[model samples]
Every structure is written in C-alpha cells, then in structure tokens.
Target: MLDAGICNYVAISYGHSGLWGGGMRQLLFNTRPSEACFGHFGAVGRYALAAQRGMHEFSSGPETWKHIAMGQRKWANLNPAAIMHAKPMSEADYHGAPLVVEPFRLFDSCQMNDGGRAIIVTSAERARDLKHRPVLIMGMGQHNPSNEIAQARYLAGPTGAHKAGRAAFAMAGIGLDDVDACQIYDCFTYTVEITMQEYGFFGRGEGENWFQGGTIEPGGTMPVNTSGGQLSEAYFMGLTPIAEAVMQLMGRCGPRQLGPETRTREPQVILCSDNGGALQSHSCLIFGRG
Candidate 1:
C-alpha cells in the first residue's frame, strides 16, 4: 500500500488526476469497484488457522510444520529486537503454547509496537545519488478477494496472493525461481506459510517445508522476513514489509542482512507480500538490482 493517502488517490486516478483537486476527490469520494475499495483486519493468525484446517489445501504436512517452526526460530535469532527473542523455543514450544486460536497461540500472533519508516522512490539513476543505491521496483501487484470472508472459496490458497504474484512476475518479466529472498508480511505465522505457497515459492502443499530446515533465515535458501517482520518487528499499518524490501535491496540491512553465503549470492531479487483484514486481502511486490 502507498504510505500516504495522497498516494492512494493518485493510484485510483491511474496517475491522471491533477495534483490535489480532482484526483483526491475521485479517490476519496468515488466508490469504484477496484481492489483499492476493500480492506480487512487480523490478517496473519486467521490465515494460518485456515491453512491448518485444510480450508485452502495447499500443503500442511510435517515438512511444512518444520519449516514454519524453523523460520520462527531464525527470526527470533536474527531479531534481538523481537519480543519473542531470548525465549528458546522448539516444535514442542509451538505445540505447548496455549492456543489463542486453534493452530495459533499468543506467540503465533504478531507483536504490536509503535514505529515509523520512510522511503523515497525515483528513477534508478537518481536513486544512486540518495543515501543508498536504489533498488528498482521491477514488478508490483495488489489484489483483494471478496470482502466477505464467508464467501471466499479457498481460505488456504489466498486467491488474491496467487493473482498478485502472477501479475507481479509478469510485470517484472521474472518468475518465482528468480527471487533470491523475500520479505513477507507475517502478522501471523500462517500468513507467511500460506504466502510461501501462494507466491509460487514452493509447491501447493510444500510451503511449510520451505519454512522448515531454516529455509527462511539469513543463511537459508530463501531468507524471509529478515527484519523480524511484524511477528517480531514493529507494526506500522502493514507498510513494514515494503520498507524491509527496500532496505534489503539497498544492502543496508544491518543485523538481519541476508548475505551471499546464505543463498550463494547477494539478495539481488526480493518478493514482498502483505495481507489485509484477516487475510481477506493480499498484495505482492517484486524488486531487484537493475
């Protein structure tokens, strides 16, 4: 999502409206049938629960479980700033934690904190002169499913994420295999798990396995949520993933840097995902070094 309200207005107008008058009105007043018209809440946990319940049926096997736990551990390790940090946990820890919602727990829920981030977008040439090298916005896509979750056909699949990924890959002229790392919005653990599958990072039911074996850590095959994410990092209206993707591309991530040793190359390509309102809505963005 755009950081400012004005950005939404500009997007609704397809960059055609004047600076502050008609565009703003069209965006704020118009009730157009667009993805931008819908919104939702409780994104992370609910999706995880739904995935576990076989509501969407991608993959929820032992491998998937292990990957998810491993990713959580890695996130805890890299993010000393995280609330769950220093609390050694294991598969047993996840299983034993009191259930907040079936298949989720207090720890499974994302941390709530206060923080702010800012980003500047310009041409790749101009980006070089800024504080850091500009990571090009090679591809970006956003989507919304039916607003009423009850009517949604696949709870686990997240049709919106699937569609968004396809659009992003098409726009960037890349594919899932091309991304070196990812920064998925993990308002809840399941959000990440489900996204892994929906974005084509893994086979339908294989996302959980991707999370296992430390696949999503700094040194793993496809490091994800490198900034601690909403799971361990602060929550800022769901824009944190966008900022993290920008940082990863700039090579400015300090403690959570995912260097070449982890994935055999600097993270030249990244995929970022976001979910809105109980996983009711989804968005994906792709970035790369030009």
Candidate 2:
C-alpha cells in the first residue's frame, strides 16, 4: 500500500477504559450474560468454568492452570504497572484459592482492570527510516464462525485458529516449527492451554506433555505470554497480546524478555492470536525481526 501511494502507517488501538475503576463492575453487569450461560455468552466466570468442566476427558489437570498462573505472576513481578505486580502467586496459593466456579479457581480468571493498548503498521521502507527497529508483520490470517453456543458442535467447532493459523503460516512462508514464542490472547488460563494446541504448537491432545518442564515459562523452549497476559497483566481484549508481541520482537520487553534465559534476545518470529465473541472470531499474525 505504501508503494501505491496509500497510507504510510496504520495504528490499531483498543481501550477498556471502562475498567478504569468502578467501571469493572459495570462490565460484568452490563454485558447481560446469563448465569446459566456457557461458553462465550454467559457470565464470564460461570461460562468459562462450565465449558471446560464438561470436557473433563481432555483435562490437562489443575497443574496446567497452576503453571500458567505461576509463570504469568513471575512476569508480573517484572512489570511495575501490571495489575498483579503487587501480588505474587505460588503453587500453594493457586491450590488454596477457592473455586469461583467448578473446575476454575479465582486465579484462572483474567483481571478486569482499566487499560489501553495499540499496534502500528507501516511499510518496510518507512520502517527503516523510522527511529526504532521495526517489527515486520510477516503474515496475517482470520476466520470466524457464526454458530451460537447452543448450536455449535461441542469440542469440534472451529474457534477458527485451525484455519487462521494454517493460513497465517502459509502466508508467512514458514511453518509452526519456525515460531520460537507466542503471545496468546489469554482471557483465562485454559484459554492459553487450548489455543496453543489449536494453533499447532503441539499435537492435538498432547498439551499435558507439551507444557511440561517449563516450556512456556521464561527461557523455556517456547515462551508464551511473557508479559503475564490477561491472567496477571491488565486485560484490554486482544490488544495487550498484540502489544506484547511488538515489544517482544522489538527487544523492548525488559525483565520479561524471552529467547535466551539469562540474556535478552528477540525471537526471529513470534505468533500472536486475537480472539473475540466466545472464541468465534479469530485472527493470527506472525511478526518478525528484519
């Protein structure tokens, strides 16, 4: 587009400014999700809990969420402005937390805090002229299904990442093996676990083993959500993950930086996913250092 004399740059931003203070309660009440609703349409807590519980046969166990909480909390310590920065978490704390809904502890839920985030798009030529090292957007893909919760196939519907991720990989001219890190849109701990699989980070139904040995933690084989994400970081829909990906590619994430364990090194390619409407809308982007 820049070559065609179109726009020079594009910026995408989102704000849950309503979460700034008393506004959080407003979100819970105003969204009008039913208490009995499941999946994306009901009260956030009850729905996410119920959906995961019904699929117990695929359970990754409590430790799955525990690691997610632990890793994200560690990143929180690195982020002075993270909502959970002042509150550290431990495995004991996760185990002790009361269940807000069956199969879901309080720590599993995302923090509903006020926040804003943005991403910028520009041509490679303009990027070179710009001050900061540009994070190249190598690939993009999206897919959305209109099925309602009641009408959708259980555990079989395309929450879309399958199609999106495949398309993204195709467009990027790379395969999943090339991705070194991920910035998943984690509205809940399970969101991270499930999405990683759908995006082809590992074989289907292998999350239990795939996540073992700190693979998703800092300095691990494949780092994920290094900013703590919606679980321990502020939630602003998908923008937080998008911004974190930009920072990761830019080598701007301070203590939470990934790649090499003891030192800061940027990944050559990172995959970021954005989800919406009860996992109905999906978009995947691959960013790289050029």
Candidate 3:
C-alpha cells in the first residue's frame, strides 16, 4: 500500500476467546488414551515442565519465579483496568498457591483472558499531526532460532533475545543505560526471567539477584510491565506489551505512568519484547519519546 500511496496508515487489531470460550484446554493437549500415555498436559503444563528443566542451570529453584509474579501483581494493583487489580498478591499468597506444574504455581502462570487490542501504524511525519503525540520507533529486530522449541539449542539460556536485543540496540545507537522502562512479554513469570537475562539486563545466571528487591516492579530501578503484563493484566499475547509501551511513551498511562517522580527516571526510552513458539521466536522494539 505504501508503494502505491493508496494508504499511509495500517491498523492492527486482534481478539481471542481462549479463556471464557473454553479454547484454552483442548488447544494443546488431549485426553485420548494414546495421548494420555505420553502426557495429557496442556500448554501450561508443557511449558512449565520445559521451563523447569531448561532453567535449572540459572535458577536455584522455583522460588525465584515468585519475584516476577509478585512484582507484576503490584503493578496490576496500580492499574484499574487490570483484571487482577482488585486482587493483590503477596509472597505468602504466591507460595501458598497450588502448583499447576512441578515448579510453577497459579501465580506464576498467566491468566487466560479474552481481550482485544488495536494499534495504528503510520509514517513519522503523519503521526506528528495525529490526535496524540507521536511515539517514535527507534529500532526493531527479530531472531527465530528454531521452529521446534525442543530442538532449540539455547532453549534454557541465551534465547533468541540475545541476538535480537543486540541488533535492536545497535540500530537504536543507544546502550542499555539509556533504557528507562521495559514492557516484557510475560506469558509466564519464567518467560520474563529468561528473556531479560538474554537481553543483557543483567549477567547470565544472575536473574535471582537482578529480579530481587523490586528491581523490575513499579518505582524500581527499571520499571517493567507497568500495565501489569499478561500475567496480571489482560492477555492479548504480544500486543499487550506493545500497547503498554505505546501508551507509556505517549504519557497516557494514568495511574501506572512512568515519570521521573514515579520511577527512577522519566521514560525517555522504552524497551519492549514479544516471544513466540515457546521462546524460540523473539522480537525486540525500542521506543523513544517523540
């Protein structure tokens, strides 16, 4: 369309009924006798098991996942639109939750939600005259290691985020120190941990320390998922993070806005991530104030 100048804008819209419509259960697994012999586990169980086995090298145990869960839950409390806004979570509440898989608790997994989100894409000059201030896209990169998660060599550590983040930052011409906030895709708490490690937010195998003491929570050194993320907010897949980043850069987030007063620094630059196919596919986008 841009080639012919038929349209200068593109709109992306998505909606899913994986939660209330009952699509979540039968989508990834079945209870047939033959399938049951291997495992009747669904996406949650399968991903949880994979993460448990794959993350053993960096994580000491399942306890570390709580930090990610509780941190995002805190952000949810600040967002009235978040599904879990009214329900606050504490360390005790997290640990007391029953395990869906061996190492993942109810809080550690994202709540399947039926939600829709839409975004508009246009040229920088066009956006300047739009309704809101333009949110500039600084850089974007993608790295898909493998289509099959089980076959991915870096399934546990150094995910596709490693190369993808490097490319995005290099394209942006900025270092990690310039990043003010993050919008990490959090289908599961462990997803955030692994992605951030590979993004070079901290040293490899040091997530247990980097995630502690509210580092990624609201008002922390690096605020992440200020919209509460897919874990506490609504699950719109990759769009959840992208939408939040757009709102934040435009200074449209009401209660969970990241400003110099609310966060360690004003959100001049933001980082967003989207993961697909069991972390085998990764995409990074760097956004800056426009």
Candidate 4:
C-alpha cells in the first residue's frame, strides 16, 4: 500500500513535468515506473535549462518567474545555511542571466542537488516498538486529471491538487479545518500560490495575497515549506515534502519547526502536495501521530 501511494504521488508530480519540451522528457521516457521517471525529470530539467541558457544564466520564465525567484530570495535571507544565501539577485541580475528557454533563467529553475531521505511506516500498534513516535498515515489521497494538457481549462490553477485534497480528506475522515500544518511542494513559486487556492487554504488568485501576508512563514498561519521547500531547499523529486511531513510530525525540524505561535499545536496533521507537468498533475497526503 505504501509503495502504491508513493508511486501515485510520484507519477502526478514528476511524471507530468518530464513531458515538458526538454531533456527531462527523454530521461522520463527512458526510465521505468512513474517514480523513477519523475526523479529523472528534476535532474534533467536542471541540466537542460542550465545548458540552454549557459552556466551563468540565473533568472528563468515570465514575470511570475521573477516573483518566485524573489520569494526564494526572501526565504534564503532567513536561512543562512542555504546554498544561495547572501546571494539574493535583483531583477537586473535576473535579466542579466542568459535566457535558457525564453523566460526561464538559471535561478528560475530548481537547483539539482544530491540528497537522500527515508520514512518508516507501520500500524499504530506496531509503532510503539520503533525508535521514535510513529506518524500515522491517517489520511492519504491521490488524483490524476485528464491527459489533455492543452485542453485543460485552467492553465495556472492546480485542478489535480483540488481533486487529490478532497480524496485525502475523505479517506482520513477529516476536514480542512482539522489540518494543523502543511508541507506543500514549492517546485515553483506559482505552484505554491496556485496550490494554496486548490487546497482551499486561500481563494482562487488569492494565493499571492496569502503569500504577501507571511501566512506561509515559520510563525505564520499556515507555516508552509518549513524545510525551505524545493525553492530554498534541495530538489529531491517529490519526496522532499514527504520527509518534511515526517519531520513536522516528529518535531525534529529545528529552526524551521512551527511552534504554538504559528500553529495551535505541534502539527498533528500535515498536508503535503506534489505537482508535475505544466501544473498538470497533483497528489496529496495527510499524516498524523498515531
């Protein structure tokens, strides 16, 4: 069951993005199973974008690209250990980066880094025997939208995220109100913005407003991306969010940990999301302590 859940999330997040017009597609097409396909997409997208725009290229994509780049810069400002820390680039610096794919600059794309993470799952009864408290997979949900990316009604909205969220809530027998914290994937800033709406954390097009209010910061209302996310943290396919969820539940996230100041309780419920393609696919899961 756990393998199946991982497969579904990976397919929605990494599989679709692999289809983008670049070497990522080639890597995915050559890989086996959906999870492996998605893993290669991140690595290939980084190399392809870097090669196309020249090693010096920094900014990438449209105006929204700049917005997300700036967001990452802000997060980096708070995280001194970040690879890109103390190196926030200005819009002019963004413009100076060689153009990779028209709008995508070097900084616009997620950095390709090396890292590995793991999680252990067991029945609530069996969890007591483990080294740490077990974070129950209280509610789990997955979704896949139509394959016709061109015909999809909302290019910017995460239709799959909405569907996956509903399914997860139903499985967990909980409502959005029960969620305490979130670890939604932030492969791109627009993705985080759109997902905030799709997950019903904010209204449509209101995600940017939520971001502006600092609701996603460590002590903010939602406390999102506590691990720096794909934006400020390392890119490890869609698995990074899974690790963050585990950390949140285990109370092991150091400075990124969301306290009572940010949340009413140590996060008992965590909502994690994964995005693939041109925001074409999504997957969600809700975790809690057993």
Candidate 5:
C-alpha cells in the first residue's frame, strides 16, 4: 500500500491466545504422517535438544543460559506490564528451576499469554507531526533457509540471523559497535545467545564470556530486552521485541525505560530480531532515533 501511495499510514496489529485451551502445538506443528516419525517433531524441545550439544560446547556449558534467563527476569521486575514483573528471581533461583528440556530449565522457555498489540507506521514527514518521538526504521533484512532442521546444515549450525543481520547492518551503514541496545527474539534463552553470536556481537564460542557478569542487563554496558522480552514478558512472537524497541527509542517506558532520565545511556540505535520456525526464518530490523 505504501509502495502504491494508497495510504501514508499503516497500523499493524497482532494477537494470540496461548493461555487459552487452544492447542498451539497442533496448529503450528501440523506435520505430515511421514514427518511425524522424524526425530525433530512436535514441540521445540526436540529441536533445542538436537542443538544442545553443539550449543553447550560452543558457548561453554548449560550454565551460560542462566545469565540470559535471569537477566531478562530482572528486567521484567521493573516493567509493570511484564507477566513476570512481580516475580523476582536470583541466580540461585535460576539454578534451582526444574529442567523443562535437557540443558534447558523452566526459566529458559517463554510463557504463552493472551494479548493484543498494535504499532503505527507512517512516512517521516507525517510522523514528525505526531505527538510522540518517531522511531525511524533504519534498515531491515530477512533470511530463511531452504532445508528443514533435519538437514545437517541447519541442525546445530548457522541461523538465518547470520545473513539477515549482515544485510541489515550493510543497509544501515553501521557496525555492531553502533548498536546501543538489542531486542532479540527470545522464544528460548539459547535463542538469544545464538542470535547474538550470529549477528557478530560476540565471536564464535565467546557467548559465555560476553553474556556473563550482567553485561546485557539493566545498568550493564548494553541493556537488552528492556521490556523483559518474551522469556519474562508476555510472548507475542516477533511483536514482543519490535514493540519494545519502539518504546525504548521513544523514551516512553516508565520505570524500566532506558535513557539519561533513568541514568542509563540514551539509546540512539537499536537492533531487533524476530526468529521463526526453529531458527530457519529470521528478520532483522535496525531502528534509530528520529
């Protein structure tokens, strides 16, 4: 519609009900009879299990995921809208969480919530007249591999974010150093780790060192998932991260807001990622202050 100049503004809305009795697994993973018997079937646990060995070796061990899960939970503690906002967690608490899948504790998985969200998109000129600070879309990229996770190339290998992030950075004419924050898709804790590594935020096998010691949490050098992310906040799929990035850039999130007002470095550039279908599909969007 924008390409045809049919409208100058667009409103995107998304809603889902994972909390309801509806069976999302059946809906999303409708596999053929032949594919049903495959090793990677049904829920995401199997897929994560297949990659756990390489992930543990590359990122050090299962302990590395604790940082991601705990960090985001802390962020959630400060966001009233977050599902986990009232639930505070500690390192000890993270360690004690029961295993949902091998190498993945209960905290590693995102919760399903029923909610609706909407974001408005308009031309820069039109946005300038709006009440709030306009978040500019600097660059965007998407990549989806042809093969399934059963393929050797995809299982425990590079994700679509590798290429998608490169294209986004190239289009934006910026390096990883320019990113002030990240709103990485966190359907699972390890998802954030892999996406960051693929985006070159850290070199191969350096995720453990980079993520440890509260590097990506509030008051850390680079705050990530400031709205608590899908892991702690309500999961709305890709919308969770994308919406949070906009609020952060606009300096609108109260209490958990990122900016000089909160004694945190003002975010000028934000990187957002949306991963889908067992890391096979990825979309990278770079947003800048407008």
Candidate 6:
C-alpha cells in the first residue's frame, strides 16, 4: 500500500479534544441518542447478567484494580512522557479513593484529557534499512460482535478479544502462552483484567491470584502495560498504548524497560490490543524481533 501510494510512511494516531464542541458539533449531536456508550458494557448490571449466564463472576474485580494501579505507577516513574509519572500511588490510595461505580474505584476509571499520539508505519524492507532497530508487526486481527451492548450475545463475557487474539496468534504462529509481555487496552483497570483472561494469558477467575507477588510487575514473568497505559499515561484512544508497545519492542524504554530477562532467557515477542465500542470490536497486534 505504501509503495502504491508513493508514501514512505503512514502515521496512525488519535487525539481527543473532549472539551471542544462548537456549533457544528451540536448540529450533529442527537438530543436522544440511540446508541449506548461503551461504558454500559463495563457497568455493574452487565456483569451481574454475565454472572447469571455462568460467565465467571467478577467478584474479585476490585482487588485486581489495586495491583494494576500500583504496577502502572511503578512504571509511570520511568516514563518521562507519562502524565502520572510524578504522582505516586499505592494500594492504600487505590482503596481509600472514592468509588466511581461500585466495585470500580476512581483510580479504575481512565480520565478524559487532551492528548495526541502518532506512529509511522513503513514497509518491512524500508524499516530494515532505517538507522534504528525496527519494531516488526508480525500479525494483526480485528473482530466485532455488535454495535450496541443490548445485542451482545454473551454479556457475562465474550468481549470479542479472544477471536481477535486467536486470529493474530495464528497469523503470528504463536500461542497465548508464548506472549512475553503485553500492552493490552486499559480504558479501565478492569479492562486489562478482563482482556488478559479473555486472551488466555491468565486462567479465568484467576486474575487476582496471578497478579499477586508482582507477576505483572516490572521484570515479572508477564510484565504488562509497562508504560502505565491509559491508567497513568495519557489516553489517546489506544494510540499511546500502541506507541508504548513499539518502544518496548525496540528496547528503547530506559527505566520503564522490562527487567533484564536475557540473563536467564530472552523475550522477542510482545502483544498489543486495541478495543472499540463496549468491547464489541477489537484488534490485536503481535511484534517480533526480526
């Protein structure tokens, strides 16, 4: 595509000016919206309905939020570009903080802020010739279940990420167990927990157990979102997370870099995910050392 377009680089980026709404914006706005916000999927009632359908109940969801928050904070310190890099937080602060929705503390909800992120995409041949080490896009996939949460087939689970991940893995010729690190979507801390489970990184209903002992921490077996993700990093509609993935794969993250796993073992694969619309749509990407 780049060759055909006569373009050497293509940039993928997303920016939000949530506070900006001119007259043109109001003109397109509907007084009665027909669609539900993606947040509806993460709401408590949906979780309850999912439990009723025998999907593993997220009873321990709150506990997992703490680990994510703390783990993200630990890395935020190393990311100079992160917004929360200076604001340290601990499990105490997470629990003591007010709840956004029951079971979801304030820390669990991603804040809306003005931000922008960009990344350039080029042909593999062109990338290889570049001065810096290139981050290879091994495989990618996308899936959509429905536009409306009301039409979701499996409210208890089934975020469509599994299908996306499976397709990407097949294309990458890898397995879920083979992913060494992840930059999964973290619109809400629970999003990360659910994604890890749906993608088979952690056994169902075992998020809390897996996170214990810093399994997802820096240098841990399954380090995740090492750039603080949307939780602490500026949320750019998943663009920032994608950028972080490329950085980590290129081994350019100075302090936020994964611990030297090479002493005992070497990791050359990393996975990244982006979600759309109440978990109804998704995409996954795999990076490899080439």
RMSD of each: 8.7, 2.9, 2.1, 8.5, 2.0, 4.2
Query: For model 6, where is the 10-residue window of minimal lDDT?
Result: 23-32
Candidate 4 Cα lDDT to native: 0.61
- TM-scores for the candidates: 0.77, 0.88, 0.93, 0.69, 0.93, 0.85
**Per-residue lDDT of 285 in model 5:** 99
**Clash number for model 6?**
1
Q: Which stretches of candidate 6 lie over 4 Å from their true place?
A: 3-6, 18-60, 261-267
- On residues 90-145, what C-alpha lDDT tens digit does candidate 3 reach at each position? 88999999977767788878877777899898888889999998998899889988
Q: Indicate whether candidate 1 or candidate 6 has the larger TM-score.
A: 6
CA lDDT, candidate 2, residue 260: 62
Q: How close is candidate 4 to the true structure, as a TM-score?
A: 0.69
Per residue, candidate 2 scores C-alpha lDDT tens digits across 1-290 of: 66787888888888766555655555354444453343332336534643474346466556777887787777777788788888889789999998876667788888877668887788888888888788888999998865454444533334578888889999999998888788898877777777787887766557768777677776677778888888888888888888888888788877677756423335889999987755677899999986
lDDT of each: 0.66, 0.74, 0.83, 0.61, 0.82, 0.72
Model 3, TM vs. native: 0.93
Candidate 1 vs candidate 6: which has greater lDDT? 6
lDDT of 6: 0.72
> Model 6, residue 118: what's the lDDT?
91
Better of 5 and 6 by lDDT: 5
User: Lowest summed-lDDT stretch of 10 residues in model 1?
Assistant: 9-18
Q: Which ten residues in a row have the lowest lDDT in candidate 4?
A: 7-16
lDDT of 4 at 281: 72
**Tens-digit lDDT track of model 4 for 1-290:** 53544422221223223334455445334444453555533333433432233222322224534555555555555555455666766778766777544335566555455444555554566566767777888776676675544365554444688888888899999988888878777765556656667788866544444565455654566666666667666666677788888877887665555566334357889988886765567888898866
